[model samples]
Target chain A: MVVSLKDIAARAGVSLSTVSNVVNGYRPVGEETRVRVQSAIDELGYAPNLSARHLRLGRTGIIALAIPELDNPYFAELAGAAIREATSQGYTLVMEDTAGSYEHELSMIDNSRRQIVDGLIFSPVAVSREDVLARPPATPMVLIGEGVYDVPHDHIAIDNIAASHVAVQHLVSLDRYRIAFIGAQAGDHRQSAHLRLRGYREALAGAGLPWDPALAAPTTAFGRADGLMAMRDLLARTQPPDAVFAYNDLVAIGAMRAVAEAGLRIPEDVAVIGIDDIEEGRFSNPTLTTISPDKEHIGRLAVQSLVARIEGKPVEPPYDVQPPFRLVTRESTLGGQRPVRT
Target chain B: MVVSLKDIAARAGVSLSTVSNVVNGYRPVGEETRVRVQSAIDELGYAPNLSARHLRLGRTGIIALAIPELDNPYFAELAGAAIREATSQGYTLVMEDTAGSYEHELSMIDNSRRQIVDGLIFSPVAVSREDVLARPPATPMVLIGEGVYDVPHDHIAIDNIAASHVAVQHLVSLDRYRIAFIGAQAGDHRQSAHLRLRGYREALAGAGLPWDPALAAPTTAFGRADGLMAMRDLLARTQPPDAVFAYNDLVAIGAMRAVAEAGLRIPEDVAVIGIDDIEEGRFSNPTLTTISPDKEHIGRLAVQSLVARIEGKPVEPPYDVQPPFRLVTRESTLGGQRPVRT
Candidate 1:
């Protein structure tokens, strides 16, 4: 049978109130009495019920982070950062993966609102602008990435559009005129892909380059096969592009393979760039030239925002976290090339 | 103002007990009365407090999973599978990332014992056998890969040593000598890596191939860069090996890049193999030859083991779930040249 404070008190020849005070370190007691009470507590092997304590305080000291997929390194790193950030602030983080499924995302949101956690940090997948904007959760919530639907909640993210534009602009600056865009899915209303595509077009227009539909091929999925297929289709064209912009690091790695298979040397023949700057990108053949978003900062900011809101403090505008991005030059684009101008 | 149950009873024109019975569906109420009570509940925006209900029952329908790093695709996929498996069993999975820290692992175990969760699925990192076995938690716990000590709990893991042996044996059967083992770590007692290394040696001995000390090189980390560095160091030798076995898929990917950079053809110039068979392996150049573990099965088994134990059932003894490993032949290993000797 499990022992309680009352049992400890009875065993120690003390009142229940005194035993409670000793356990909580509330009221001062004589040194001898404290030791006796501690000995009794240890002998009984009592375990405090954190859940009951949480219920009494109306605070669970737990937070939930809902991500699309942990298999994706981007989300994985994000989760690690968030966990570290949350733990440092005295909150335990529980990660939930939805695998980018719409129904799963909705169910996770509903579950989070059920108070399993005091607040939620969600990177939703397949949530429409209408659904998110119209039905923001009635609990403390923070939105991560491009699914911001004008909801009045903290939104933490990097500049996908600017990052894309800068990446493409770096390629242009290298005088790679025939640039191809690969690994995008058409009709993806996700703010991330949509904004990045918009930035790609903007970069093209600013450089006085014609937006060639043939150069902007979309892929069915975001895996390496899609990247390879997209690159293969581009290379099969009569006038192959000198450079390719991939959706992410994995896509870029696959496209690089396709380029090598076509007997093309990186930079010397076809330049490539990607986003997310995954660890593998640093060791990819020719390494990868890409835009590196501050993923750690994004995670830290998301946790800070959620924790602050959960504590009932008036947080600065919730959508205030906008992490910076950097363009990492590597062998794919060659070093020290003046950026191409219109 | 929050509406209470008393208000709901008054609005429904019924006794509080009748309203409670109708709300909880305890006793059969008249259809008219049920509808009236339901309407009153909706009007009051009443949502039952599951936490309070759980406290009354002294049971929380939650399980916790503690893993090292989600940044590793294998672990991420494992977490996803575990979540799916637990949800199917009518329990919620709470994920915690320990970042492979021993202190964090201990904390998770302590919390689990403190009733933070009904049961735990823990994949501990940086923990010694004595640390866990010496003081096993009283709660139902399933130890995952990297088993510390014999904690008298269910363990779900693939035979890493045998899996690695199978991978090398496949290479040996191909008559590919001059083999190099990449990504070995010094003084690391992680059962997976150490056992896999042991299997590698056993396979070489069985093949009558002398173990070459120069061929076993340890890397600082298990990332792509570490793989690339190890591969490059091996290739720079006066006589490069004809084949290489990597610790995992990420390391293999790096080795592939290095081999390609050296203008070597896969399978023909240098055969490459790895474990895990990550999804990225399918799209890699020359694809990958790997030992595939049943990640989904391991995940499901972990959940079933914990849930069954929680219900006080005598789980199968040894609970040592050693699943089989399949050697998937890809372009990385010459399909036509695999020589079988008695």
Candidate 2:
């Protein structure tokens, strides 16, 4: 009869988990318990399959996924997707919150000294491309999200430029002119805001609409509070735009609130649109019109690519993979007779 | 001069992380690299303070926080809070999604045989109290959320019964007599649903309003989709209640959507209230009116409790904590007049 881990645990007078640990080497085992487990294993003649795999791969069988912050529904949702994908690929995804700090991101890279994680999938909101490239992480990593670094790494993100262009064109299709672009981080190359802003300008130019610099409102942060503040500033102007295209859903939701607070109607006085189809958008007042970049797919691709690189598979340079996006038309941008409660 | 890890890395001609691995004894180093690192350490007259700390405390300096899923905004926001609290305490918070499976939770406990994580903070959604207690994790653990496992370990959660009572009382004070309870898991004693349902009955009894079992709608899950379905089920009743008290914000938001889809005016037709003031609920159309249980405080307390237990501190038995809750009145449950465009 085959000696199972359970049989060894029983013989060693320890838990099944203890026997598994002694074989896996993922965690440090106590000296006395470890010896007892080894003795039981020797007598039982049992060898764990995972132990051989870990030894051959020089791995902890753990993958680290670093995101800026989980407070944002976008990142939180992305993390959930990443976890599912990682689990399916036979690795544990350990989430790390970089807290949107460049220094913190650098420190995480420094953690390679301990060699605890086998691979990394990072989505940085704070670290600059220059800073990231200056001191690269030693482990095989796949970059995901807003900005791409100037390093030979597998990158996964939705084409923010094309997606933004589609979102703006959708607003234009609704006969909305004098459109305002909220959330402009003009000087930041690492911010997706820059690419989205470019897309917005291109869409306006293509439609033969005159660019109004005054209509381009800038927000300090890509969050609801900042979006609200930016919308208020736009409204305070003598000639506010007839439409508002926010950078992301959080900004759009904030702008929606500002319009409601100002006693203005959505899609009538000012149409609203955004990117990133976060789940919150589904329940938002009037709902949100957005460009849906499949986050679950992005999560799956990130893990697959990182695992591929770790297994010494041939991955070519400029390993950027931009997933396709689709326009999601919802009530906010669709102007019609508002549904009234009977 | 005191030697640093950097010096050892330079002496060994290996990466800083590689030197760290050999010194920490947490990971397996290549035989050649291990030999080089040891030689470098002896020559450099180095004594790692971190190494001594790790050995003396039997700590990984990393804490594993296992939650059911981050797709739910409550857990997502709680994760953000926990990360911040863990950072302040000089511990790295490693997030693990238990996939809401009892087997997954047990497997994680089994991982403790390796003794990698110093401690654990678990919020189990699927595991029953008996199962969790019968096969306790080898590591020091603190349980948070939903059900409390009857073990010697610490537990942290909101007083769901009291919180639910207050939420129902608030609806009653609004002169809403036919109040329906959304999200009841009738037979599951391990679920907080039982306690919340009890609270709903007591509140109805105190107000001299008769309790109707038909009004206590059951949900398969504690998320948005289930809430939507449960609300639809309630609406199908011959004489549906005029108000709903949801199990949590996700369910409440889902219920709110069903109400709107049925073309019913909130507060006027069906005022809705829920527990857990998730961030997404703040932006939900008609903004959710709910109980704001301090999730951030709960996250902080769980880490603090686990760390205290790990440090061999004088932590008493039945170390359960229930932080206070506050009511947040919002647009969804206070419908009166429509804000018209100027």
Candidate 3:
């Protein structure tokens, strides 16, 4: 049972305000009264409801994680990691799924701030840089995605450009040419997609391969279904690429399935790679070869950064957190190459 | 941007409480002043902070969904569904991951009640019927997951015993006599696990097959890794079953992986099936066959039940909610039998 502060006050023979002052150290109280209140608190084993305590101090001990898709393995793992890190720091984490709506993302920002949350760890799908900039955030927020808000306020990101370049270059190292860049979100300049496309082009030039726009498979959405559809369209073309660097693990997994359905073997018929080392990627038919962004560590850093801001600590300039990345070599991209399926 | 009620009050030249009283319709106000205040509110586009309003009214438009593991796809899907349902009914859903800990589940219950959340939709992993009855709920709560909760609190459960019986019956229909029931947690009588075991045993008895404990592959935990380890151990035995019925989709998935590694063809060699038709199951190497509980509908009901209670509506006596179930047939348990991979 929770022992409320009122119970402590009653036992101490003091008013609620007196007990509050003693608990919060908000104002000076007589030594005798303070001692009596303290003893009463100790005797009752009072564990203050964190919410009330946070409210009095202009906080709520609650941080919200706003993500685009909770069902997405990437976001699920990130949420799990974040919840653990936040709970370890004596804070509760509440997850909000925006369901890939930009306007909904904005409301989440407003809701988290208004509903007593101390901070927000946001992974926005819809809201744009202009939206974030025009409406400055009311609460301390740490964003996890490619650069969206130019005006920095604690954004955590993996270098999409560098990561994409690495993914493509790794395929080139495998002596695979005719590389396809799957999941090209043409007009949507969401940092991750746009930057990744740019990196793919750069990597092609570096590999001494001519740019082929036809090989860039455009996807309407960043999911397995989109990848499958795009890959199907690519295969229907005159010349399908021998290799693909998908948008993310989901896209890659989908594209690989298409390859299998078309009677082709992984790596041998069409090598595939993606970003986000999600759990599904590890368990897929042929384990995925992808970029691992140490998401768990990044989650921990996000929590620590938010906590520092919540406690009124000064966060340094260049408020961007760039964690290290790894290339997970797996069967999908590596099993010894054989003659391509007709 | 959210326009606060305080802004409206200032514009109307009224005190905060007067403006609140007018907006809430708690007390009568002079017609002229009410019109003046309403116009000002409309002009200012004042939106009340739900949490603050709830502080006065004691019904925050927020509910928490507490689950064992957020990383688990089933829970993630359930959370996504719950979020949608709650949002449709004008409530925000906050997810709490218990991390498969009983103590954590208890704390989540306490925290949700203590925090601003008006109600809780909980799927507990640890706390027992004794713990629950001993410390009657402090706030309106609806429990999910079978029948460990005996006391009449709002509960949402899939009839575990019946579901398991159906699963085993399906496997038996496939003309497989040596059916192994995987993931039998012996001592821990958490409703789902305990009842599932009972159903499996009952199904065998009904089939006129003598109970052979050797074919019951008991698992220490309910994850894919545990499923894999248990299956591996079962495979090492001199007499392994011709078919397997796993605890859940995740466990089934792991066991399937073990079957593949052991050079056994799915269905053709060792037919396998599981419960919880998770998305991953649909896309596994050879698509998994499993039971599909209408989790989305169940999630919606959970929210509605809590909302009804929060609105002070009298909940009926039979607080248990049992959603309909389905058996999905897929390649893993069907597809024309190929020669055993030996």
lDDT string for model 2 (A143-237, tens) is 89876555677788888889888988998998988899989986774568888899999999999899998888887778887777888889889
DockQ of 2: 0.40
Model 1, B41-63: lDDT tens digits are 77777754333233223345678
Local accuracy of candidate 3 as per-residue lDDT tens digits, A160-215: 88998899999999898889988888677556888899999999999999999999
Ranking by DockQ: 2, 3, 1
Model 2, residue A306: C-alpha shift (Å): 1.0
Off by over 4 Å in 3: A1-7, A14-45, A49-56, A336-342, B1-7, B15-45, B49-56, B336-342
Q: CA lDDT of A334 in candidate 3?
A: 90
Q: Write the per-residue lDDT of candidate 1 for residues A213-263, one digit (tens) a residue.
A: 899878765666678778888999999999998888877877887887787
Q: Please tell me the TM-score of chain A for candidate 2.
A: 0.84
| Model 1 chain B: worst 10 consecutive residues (lDDT sum) | B49-58
Per-prediction RMSD in angstroms? Answer: 7.6, 4.9, 5.7
lDDT (C-alpha, whole model) for all candidates:
0.76, 0.79, 0.78
Per-residue lDDT tens digits of candidate 3, residues B122-175? 888688877677654466788888635676678888888889888889888888
Q: What number of clashing residue pairs does each candidate have, in the order they appear?
A: 4, 3, 1
- Model 2 over residues B1-342: C-alpha lDDT tens digits? 989889999989999999877786655677788788878887887855334445435566678888886777777778778878887776778888887777677666554324457888888776666667776346788889766556667888888889988999999999999999988885664478888998999999998999899999988778777777888878988998899999889889888878877778898899999988876666556777899988889888888888777777897875778887999888777874332111
Candidate 1 clashing pairs, residues 3+ apart or interchain = A154-A318, A173-A339, A173-A340, B129-B148
Looking at model 3, how many pairs of residues clash?
Answer: 1
List iRMS for all predictions: 9.9, 6.0, 9.2
Model 2 steric clash pairs: A27-B114, A113-B17, A285-B285
